[model samples]
Target chain A: MIAAIRVFGYSLFAIFIGLLFMGIGRKIIARIQLRLGPPFYQAFLDVGKLFARKSITHNFVMDLGMIMSLAGLLSTMLFVPVAGHMAIKTSSNLILIIYLMAIGHLGMAMAAAASGNPNATIGVSRALTMMLGYEIPFFTVMLGLIIFNGTSSLELIAQSQAGGILNWNMVKFPLGFLAAEIALQAIMGEKPFDAMVAPAEIASGPMVELGGKYLGLAFLTHAVSIFVETGIMVNLFMGGASNVFTFVLKQFEIYLITILIEAVFPRFRIEQAVKFLWTVPMSIAVVQLAIILL
Target chain B: MMDSPSYMLSKIAEKDNLTVYELFFGPNHPGMHGNFGYVLEMIGTEIVKVRPNAGHLHRGFEKLMEQKLWVQNIALVPRICVADPDPNEVAYCTAIEKILRVDIPDRAKFLRTITLEMSRLSSFLMGMGALAAAVGLYTAMNIMTADRDLILDLFEWLTGARVYHMFSIPGGVRNDLADGFVERLYKVLDHLEKRLIEYDKLLFENPIIHKRLKGLGYVSKEDAVKYGLTGPNLRASGNPYDVRVDDPYAAYPYLDVRVITQEGGDALTRAIQIRLEFEETINLIRRALKTMPEGEIRLNLGNLSALKVPKGEAYAKVESSKGEFGYYVVSDGGMKPYRVAVRGPSLPAGLLLAQKHLPKMKIDDVAAWMASLAICPPDIDK
Candidate 1:
């Protein structure tokens, strides 16, 4: 019963931090464009308004898909060590976390495909193609760290880099961090890698058919995703902070890099984006792995 | 009875077990510039065939012009191309002036030139913004829109209306240069000049933008001429045929209007062509303002409502932001025009070029292609 309460509280914390980051990100983007943006609490208001409204569903699969997407990400959040605190007391396995994140994306693809809109199908295909593009470099970077640290556990790696800033994996493995940074940009669906959600091209892709509560759920799923992805990044490279506040601050720093890049850059075509990922980041990751092996 | 090309294609696709689906890409889609749509047939993400679905924004502009008096049609003409309305008014008025055999005062010519350059600046901003947005760079779109608003503010101060200004009439502009308008115009130009460097950093120099736009739509010099392409699109393909420089309409002959052209015949070249011309337009406007002679703003045709033209036909053309906007007018020596046909700039690119280019292109490139070509839907439908 106590463990269940801790899990619920941690999930709420992750959602809140993620939503806050999203709101702040919008404000930053607006300022970059020389426009006054919405308040920092705008995402909360948006989610609230969406949940209050009515929604249409194509079928049971859509409902299941949306729920499973949110659930999958939320469960992945449990595995990520936030300030050295795991909601479920088990080793934060990096491989399992990565595998779980794919389920979230698969759920969204399934829901979008079920909607039967050609644009949505195109979006889903692009998204899946993007996933294939980013994951190779991402896994190669992770493989370097796992081999160097002699473990696939995220918490153990964070503990190993606990001495100081210089001891952090980021400083030691700069090339791996650079490769991971590029992969993270795709992972977060930012510009130069955001063809899947190209609003001008495919009417915002997978979210085309979602409305009302379904959209609200998708927002929550995205918020949780931001938390999980950034959380993993911080644990991997930033030496996972000693407390929650510092951990979230590090996550914001990571998210800030992506938001700044997102604000200025135009999207690449899916093929172009995939080709770039395979060439640039993949080679960087391979070089980093070579350095570690040597 | 069942011998349609689409049906035959579908049957062939079914034999090969290829799933072909139809997607409507506007009238409601965000990427579309106006109330225009394309019925796109697709296999996977590539567009197999495209049927341009127009008439969504048709207000029967040519027919509407016939119903109104000659002076009253000035208000109707600007509605044909909302983004660059001045070209329509200038072309129509120039045609009327030609038929009447009236040489507009030198001061009026300079004023027309100023207004024409201003309109081009506004249209280029919108076109560039739309192009950036089509590639998913909302930051560039937002910045360009904010800058465009500054021009709109100048327009509102000069002419009481922000858009659809019936400022340019047959004889001259409705209002002379207002008090201190030139100083304010210069100030805005200076501010825009500073912003251009920032725009270069944010959009033009962006490598991803280059990757998305480079060679996406290749129009050769021969194809550009054969397809009846005009304006910056034609200029981008190494063609130096600028209506302003070649025909010398309005005050262009008086001013040092140098024709700007690019050698590369691709979407990126077209974008750079607009950027180069935007700078040239700013310089041209500054020159016109400085060299403007002080004289009567209009020819004072007594009671313009009762004015009639001689039995003659005249076609006058002006270089708009999109291309050459031509007005062919036939007057029957009556209060109203007998026939007025507007030759809109967007027709060749929107209708003709899209047919040639859109097939085999990916779905993502359609909006960007339309934006790079500056395909205005209202002009196409009109």
Candidate 2:
């Protein structure tokens, strides 16, 4: 019972903070475009309104898929160390965390396919293709970090670099860090690689059929995704913070950099996006791996 | 078994050893610009066939104009093309002027030129913004939209109506330029000059945008002409044909408007061509304002409601923001027109050209391609 409470508390905390970050990101983007944006708590209102509305379902699979998607991300977040703190207090294996997070994407695909929306199907297909593109370089870069530190546990790698700024892997393996940064942008589904969610092209892609509570669940999933991906990046290179406040601050800094790029650049086609990820970031990751292995 | 629902489902699932799926592109969709739909046949993400469905926004302007008097039709014609309405009014009035043999005052011609150029600026801004929005760059869209509002402000000040200004009548414009209108127009132009540079850096010069747009939709010079493409779309294919230059109307005869052309007939070149013309439009507005003569704004046709046009047929064409928008008017010495026909620019481009190009295109390029082509569905349906 105690363990259940602890896990439930952590999940709620992650959801709350993630939603807050999303709201702030929108406000910042709006300010960049010279408009008065929504309130900083607008995400909460959006989620509230979504959950309060009646949701439609095509099949039993859609209901299960929505639950599975949210549950999968929540499970993935459980393994992620937030500011040197883990909710489950188990081995924070980087490889295990990566695979667990993929379940969320698969769950979304299942729900979208179940809803029988072609746009959703196209979105899911593009998303999976983008995943195939970005994951290779991201995994290779993570491998370099793993080989350098002689461990696959995220907590150990983060703890190893916690002494000072210079001790951060971002300084040691600069090429890998650069490659990981680019891969992270794709993972977060920002502008250039965001063809999966291309609103004008595919009617917002995977979320085309999602409405009411299903959309709310999707929003929560996205928030948690931002948390997990940024948590991993912060732990991997930025030297995971000793406290929750500073850790979230580092995540905010990373998200702001992405939004800046998102504001200026246009989207790449799925093929062009994959081609770019393979050519530039892939080469950098491979070079970084060679240096680490040697 | 043949009539069962399960069998029907199975039949839809498989067809001729290949899964053929039908996708609705709009009528009500974010991907489409206006109330337009495309029934697209697809095998996976590759589009196999496209059937363009328009007419959801059909206001029946041509038939409606035949019921109204010649002067009253000024209010009706502007509704034909929403993005650039001035050209519709200019075309309609010019057609009537050709029949009535009324030479508009020189000052009215200059004012009409200014209004047309201003209309083009606002329309190009919308086109650019939509292009950016299609590519998922909402920042550029919002900035361009906000800047476009400044021009609308100038319009509101001049004609008292921002969008559908019944400013152009049968003889000339309804009213002269408002007080300090030229100074305010210059201010808006100065602001646009700075914004255009920022837009170039943010969107046009960005390598990612270049990759997304360049060579995506290729319309060759011969194909562009063959397909009846006009204005920037045709010019992008190295054809220096502009109705403003080829058949000068209004103040264009007095004003030396430079026709800008590009060699590449692709989406990127088309976009670049609009930006180039935006600059030329600003320069033309400035020249027209400077050389504008002071005279009567209208020819004072007695009793606007009961005015009778002579028995004649006249066709007038104006280079709108989209392409050459032509108005054909026939009069049999009656208050109402005997027949009125609008040769909208987007009909061929939207229906014929889209049917030709949309097939074999990746599903992702459909929206961006439409936006870059600037297919105004209202014009097509009108």
Candidate 3:
């Protein structure tokens, strides 16, 4: 029961940190352009507003997609270890996490495509490009970790990283961290990699067509995804923050770096992005592996 | 002689009996803005040919301008190029000013310069923002527009309007700067400088942005000049020509200014040219603020009803942020102009650039290339 409390504490802390960055990202982007932006609680308010909104049904498929999205997120979250242990963990669940993550993304993409809006159609295509580009590096990094640990259990991967922060897997196998870092930013759907949801380009891609309670579900799913993914990254690399405070701080550090990238760069086209992820970072991963073996 | 998208669409029937496809690009497409459309024959993603379709935003300015009083038409013209509207006001007023022979005051000239440069900066921010958005750097684009809102606020404070300023009269400006407006303006400039670094990080140095934008919308200098592309698009093709330098209107003669140009006439070059010119516009605004002389705001328009001019035509052009905007006026010893024809810069570029220049490009790059042309369709249809 004490172990259960720690796991709950970590997930809640991760969610809070993720929500904070989402708000900060919007405000900072506004402030950078000489405007006084939205209030810091804007993200929280937006989510609160989301739940309070009236529910409108478009098609039953939308609910199906919505439920699938939330389920995928919750399933992914369950597999993620908190303090090197999970609320529910299994050895074969790494494969389940991969499917859950991809399906959640696909469900959102399919939902957007089914909405019959032209911009939504374009958004789905962009999402496909992002998924294709990002998943390759993400899985490759996962494979490297799996091989390194000699097991696919996320709990085992988390345990291997712990020996103090300096002896963390990120420090020992810097290339995995480096490669995963690039993929992680893309995975988080941050800017530069956020072409999928480029508001001006396709008017909010994927979720542009979704509205009322439907969009709220998508937003909640995204919030949960961020918490789960950041928690997973911390478990694998940063070694679970030692306490609740440290976990929150580490997740925030990741979020700030993503914001810095967002503040600094324009996005790449799908073709260019594919080339960037597959070649450059994979090469970096190879070099990282060489350093590890040598 | 130009075939419709249907005509070229028909030629596909004879060649291998390929199915003729009619596709619409906008009024709702991801790339289009403020109501635009392109009827094109697209084979997969490659645009075999494109037919330009406009008139969604046809405000009928030629008709509207005739209905409104000469003073009120000042409000009508600026909507031609929403990104840069000051030149619209200037060209129309100057045409009327020419017919009336109103010797605008020295302070009015400087105010015109200030307003024009402010509009230029705001518009440039938007163009760069749209260009970034075209290729999908959304954060950078949002940053630009959200920042552009502040400049619009500044205009609103000065002119009592968010858009359609109607601030410039034929003889002079409507109002002077409110107290501390200049100081606030400087603070905005400082903030803009700092914000540009954030944009630099998110967009300028990012390798993905380069690959997508650069070399994708390549338009040669010959085609650029032939199509009458002006402003940043012309300059991007290595053409150093600017109406500001060539004609030297308003306070342009008093203030020393330089033209910015680039070697490649592509979308990326156009974007870069605009980026560099933004700095120049800021400098011009600062200079106008410093060198502004205290004087009256208007020329002596003692008589409003019996305005007359020599029965000849005078055409005046200004280097608007979008392109070269000109007004042709013919007076017949009357209160209203005999025939007043306003030539907007983006009009021709929209027609020729999309119709002629956009062939062989992928449908995905169409928006980026169109943005590079900076075609304001209302300017054309109006």
Scored by TM-score, the top model is: 2
TM score of chain A per candidate? 0.99, 0.98, 0.87
Between prediction 1 and prediction 3, which has the larger TM-score?
1
Off by over 4 Å in 2: B1-11, B16-18
Cα error of candidate 1 at position B187, Å = 1.7
Candidates arranged by DockQ, highest first: 2, 1, 3
Model 3 B-chain TM: 0.92
How close is every model to the real structure, measured as TM-score?
A: 0.97, 0.98, 0.85
User: Can you tell me which runs of candidate 3 are displaced by over 4 Å?
Assistant: A1-21, A24-36, A39-60, A241-249, B1-25, B28-31, B39-51, B101-107, B136-163, B175-206, B285-296, B303-312, B357-360
Candidate 2 C-alpha lDDT tens digits along A147-227: 989999999999999889999999999999999999999999997899999988889888998999999999999988888
Ranking by TM-score: 2, 1, 3
Error of 2 at B315 (Å): 0.3
| Docking quality tier of model 3 | acceptable
Which clashing pairs does model 3 show?
A264-B201, A264-B202, A264-B203, A265-B201, A265-B202, A265-B203, A266-B202, A266-B203
Chain A of candidate 3 gets a TM-score of: 0.87
